[model samples]
Target: MNEELNARLLELLARIEPLLPPEQAPIDWSRDVAAIWQRHALGGRLTAVAPRDGVRVEELVGIDHQKQALLDNTRAFLRGRPANHALLWGARGTGKSSLIRALLNDLGDEGLRLIQVDRHDLVGLPTLVQSLRGSDYRFVVYCDDLSFEGSDDAYKALKSVLDGTLTGPPDNVLLYATSNRRHLLPERMADNSDTRIEGGEIHHGDAVEEKISLSDRFGLWLSFYPFDQSTYLAACRHWVAHLGGRFDTDAEAAARRFALERGVRSGRAAWQFAISWVGRQ
Candidate 1:
């Protein structure tokens, strides 16, 4: 009876053992600890250093300086050097976010990772840092379409992550963000400033200035403006030529006509028009 009872107890314990928290290295005072842990869900997110196993971020168009600036930064990080947090700001659909991914794909090492933290997840910034603090891989915490508006408290968490008084972000980590608004707000208006004075609200102006300062925290700021008439036409020509005689007419005229009809001249608009033209065949 005693032997039978011991076997049953061992079987029960084995079933529950796998559910317990993983064992850590023997906690030793002499050992310098970095709290970095592998992100189990990284492959699922399509954000983190993408499992280069097979991910495709669309190729970015037209922004030459923007592309090189980003590539340079990522290269430095991969080489284990200091790199600045970046803010990619400007007109909508300028491929700010796409460029970030492409740069990572082009330069990131197995040791470096891209962890996308959504705007809604801003409150968890510190938690992310704590989790990543000890890891050897460099991290690019990416935020897309990030901005603060209408009493949003998430910015407070972000400000801390950007340049916290308690502790700077780990050398192994950096941040990259994309925003449509230069100030990331609604014309720099304040909740109470509108009621106080119309011509000049001193307090509101200061508040706007503060919001702008958050963007300034970025060491590298890359602005993507609307593409020009020639650039737009060039993009069309590039696409058409790349396709090798897809269109019979000269691309310059059609590109101009497309931009005029769309009422916008941007890299994204250029690509959209090009894709549409290609599909016509």
Candidate 2:
């Protein structure tokens, strides 16, 4: 009995004082936070890819309706009016990004700053907001080509950034996004299969419908369709004349050649064709 008792006591001591397997030093959360805080401009100091002067809004040329719609929203934002979060959706290369950049130049001097965060960086938005929560200047958090492709988690983070569940979008911040997908998803035909829970009844109070409902978050939805020949030629003529390029490239003839070459027509094509034709200069 004594021997058994002694062995058990030894075992307990060994287990209790096993050197703690070389304890890992506690993580310094404050230091970690400070490090992150330093590297990221939580105060909303913007770092645009191309500085403002390079982006000339007055020179965007054409798409008067599209330009006017966006400029109006931007002006509203500048005035602290009840402005809507905008979603610029449509054909690729149709000045979606250009519009956002142009707005910064047009309004940057009005205490407005455009901070472009890459799509993958959307998850860091909470941290970003927390950092910039107390700033005085207004901000436009621009995301180019934003969409979901098995990236539901990123969307969740963006939902909070767009319209927070608890804090809501910071009064100083507005999100402007450009996407090719109208629904922001691939428009899967299968989504309809589940939106029906009891045969012909739209499924509410469910994840699938909830996900499909994300588009409603944005107040404005603008579409940029491919341009017709006249608009295309006008775009080419505008850019060529403005940039002082070789414009005698037969405006009408060049317009046809641009469409025939690309098999598509849009402001983007017009600009590209103009650049190519100017090589003749």
Candidate 3:
């Protein structure tokens, strides 16, 4: 009777085992250059992934100042020098995310590895950073399209990882995030209703301070703007030429029409136009 009860318990355990999150596969830091942070019911784990290919830094056009600033900071970090966490904030479809990918491609040979984490999974950031401590390879903890709604509690986790912690992030790890919102939090007119002046000095209310504090932790801030017509056209021409398509007068006219129809010009738009234009030829 005891043996039969044990057998029944074993059978029930087997039935439920497969529903649990799979064990995280061990990552070979020396072999893999990129990974993604995956959250699960148990906690979170890093999954090795292939780094994106064919995105050269040279191919990124129309944001020279932003590119150079980030590159310099990254280079400093790679050399074990002081470097600040970077926040790339600006217009949609600009080269914010592309620059990070390109940096990985350009510097991966020099012991740079990328670990991408989603904003939703950021609650695990401190644990993740602690695990990567004392590693030989430098890590870029990348969060793409990061932003928080007013009610989101996830930003607290991020803030803790950035500066609120006692020990702070490891020397080998730095966070690089991209967002369309400069502050990474939604702002409303009501939030500013508490603003007041005293002793000829202006003071912000608790709500305003809360929003600004998150972005302030990132020491390096780079802003990207919408590309002008000339810059947009130049990018279109560059991509077309790179893709083995001729950007002649006719192609230029067509590109202009494409941009006009879209109502916004950006590096992404230019790349799309190039793909469509080159595919026909």
Candidate 4:
């Protein structure tokens, strides 16, 4: 009876051995357009961004210069040359985040992978970076609409990753963040008022310095401002043309009315107008 039991245990062990290897396998990063990372108490999880749902790079308009600069920076990183962690800062509805997504789509085939890390999940930066380190692909750890509030210490992890790390940022990765505030914080008249007098000279408060320093960490700063009338209309025309020239009516006049009603002129506003315009016809 003892010999028969030992043989049965060995047979079960052999069947279970095959399943163990697969459980320990590394993540399959090759099959997706992008990954949205969320941290849990146990570990991090990645949700794939399907290619069908991704926006193409060419879909953007009226910001060709900004787009080209970002593309060039991305290309430099892809080639293993020196590159800077970039910050896209400017007004709302100006396509700051859209440009980054578009760049990722444009370069997805070249082994450029994008991992979107949420602003709240920034505390998990070390873990996220560790996972991407020594990987075969180049990664853009992106943070959209990143900002900080009063004494909000969440920016610390990102600050260290940006430039303060002892070993510096990982060679295989780069950070691309988009923010409405150039300083990554909303300025308050009170924060600046609390100044120190050192040797009878007034200096800014630590709180102000802390906010400014965070933005300083980024090596590349790209600004996106609101568009003018002609530029906004031009963008509308481009989008209309790309959508197979489907609009029978004058898209320019309609776009101008939309921009006026919205009280904002930006690439995002133009895209919104185009969508609504197309839907109506």
Candidate 5:
């Protein structure tokens, strides 16, 4: 009877073993320059990905001041000098995310690597950082479209990774995040109701303080704004020419009409127009 029960247990164990998640394969950092953080029941892993192509730093227009500032900081970081984690915040489709991607394409040959992490997957940031601590390549852990609702707690993990914990982020790694929200958190009217003046100084409520603290952790803050008429047309011309389209007088009029229909002129809108105009020709 004991041997019969043992046989049944062995059969069950064999079936369960095949259903378990496999151990993650080690990334070849020497060859791959990018990855995405993927979380699972058994912790998390970095899945290697091919770097995106066709975005060059020179092609980005109208945000030259922001482009140069981030470039200087990144150059300093690659040279092993003191640099701060950067936060790029502002209007949607305003080239905030493009600048980061362009930075990677510009400096990739200089040992700069990128690892993209979703805002929801930030809870595993410490683990991800730990894994990259020993790597020789400098990593930019990018989080795109990062914003949090009032009830979300994942920001706590990101806060700890940024500056809260004693371990802190390693020297070989820096974080670059882009968000449409300047504060990265939703603000409620009630949150401002508790403000008061004391000693001739205004004090923010605890709720406001909590929201500001996260953005404050980033030492470098870059702001992006909506493009004006001349800037928007310039961007359209650049992309249209790059995409093998002629940006003549008629094309300029069409681009303006396109922007009017969309109700906002941005780098993304310009690119979309370029594609449409070029494809139609």
Candidate 6:
């Protein structure tokens, strides 16, 4: 009777085995230069971007100082030297994000990994950092167009990660973010309206402190400004030459008109003009 019961249990177990979930696959970290982490209802999802898809350093124009600063810092990091977390803050369409992508591709052989995290996913940073701690490849957790609003709790999560609790940032990882706002926080004139005076000394508002301190956490701050008309035109010329095309008098005038119409001369605006010209040809 005991042997019969045991046989019945074994049969039941075998029947349930195939229905159970399979073991999770190990992460293939070597697969890509950069990855986008998308948060889901269940957990997190990762999408890989091909290395060749990223822009090269030579392709960028009109931000030589900013570019060199980033390249030098990145090279120092890759050499196993101390490197600061970088913040690229400036105007829109000024190649802030491009420099990062280009640098990664430029130094691909050095095992640099770029993990792009969205503002919404900042809460998951601790988990992400832990997973990367033991990896052999160096990582730059990139946040592009990052900014926080007044009621954003995500900022707290990021603050904690950036502040580095006690253990500090993982040796193999760094945080690099680009933003149009220098402080990575939205500000209003009213935010400064409520200042306090303590011990006969006027102090700034809490809102100002909160916004500015986040940027201060970063050791390196690289600023990018909108390009001038000549810089923009030069960029257009560079792209034309690279694409094996010439900028005739009509085309040059048209490109200037395009910039004027846009009301902003920038690297991106220049590129758009170049691409449009190439299409016409």
All candidates: CA RMSD in angstroms? Answer: 8.3, 9.7, 3.8, 6.9, 4.0, 5.9
In model 1, the worst 10-residue window by lDDT is: 41-50
- Ten residues in sequence with the least summed lDDT for candidate 6: 195-204
Error of 3 at 81 (Å): 0.4
lDDT per residue for candidate 3 within 179-270, as digits (tens), equals 99999999877666665653343554766788899999999999999999999999999999999999999889999999999999999999
- Best candidate, TM-score: 3
TM-score of each: 0.71, 0.76, 0.92, 0.84, 0.91, 0.84
Please list the C-alpha lDDT of all candidates, in the order they appear.
Answer: 0.69, 0.69, 0.92, 0.82, 0.90, 0.82
In model 3, the clashing pairs are: none
lDDT, candidate 1, 5-97, per-residue tens: 999999998998886556445322123221222232221112212233221233556788888887778778867788889999998867787
Regions of candidate 3 where Cα sits further than 4 Å from its true position: 1-12, 195-204
* Candidate 4 C-alpha lDDT tens digits along 72-190: 99999999999989999998988888888888778988889988999888888878887788988999999999988866788999999888878877898999999988998878766
Arrange candidates by lDDT, highest first: which order? 3, 5, 6, 4, 2, 1
Compared with the true structure, model 3 gives a TM-score of 0.92
- Candidate 4, residue 6: Cα displacement in angstroms equals 27
Better structure of 1 and 5 per TM-score: 5
lDDT of 6 by residue, 148-191 (tens): 88778887767777774888778888899999988887877766
* Candidate with maximal lDDT: 3
In TM-score terms, candidate 5 sits at 0.91
Prediction-by-prediction clash tally? 6, 0, 0, 0, 0, 0
Per residue, candidate 2 scores C-alpha lDDT tens digits across 72-149 of 887888788978788889887778888887786677667666766766667777777665666676777777888887
Which residue ranges in model 5 land beyond 4 Å of their true spot? 1-24, 195-204
Ranked by lDDT, the better of candidates 4 and 5 is 5
Ranking by TM-score: 3, 5, 6, 4, 2, 1
81-146: candidate 5 lDDT, tens digit per residue: 999999999999999989998987899999999999998898888888988887789999999999
What lDDT does model 3 reach? Answer: 0.92
What TM-score does candidate 6 get on C-alpha atoms?
Answer: 0.84
Candidate 4 has an lDDT of 0.82
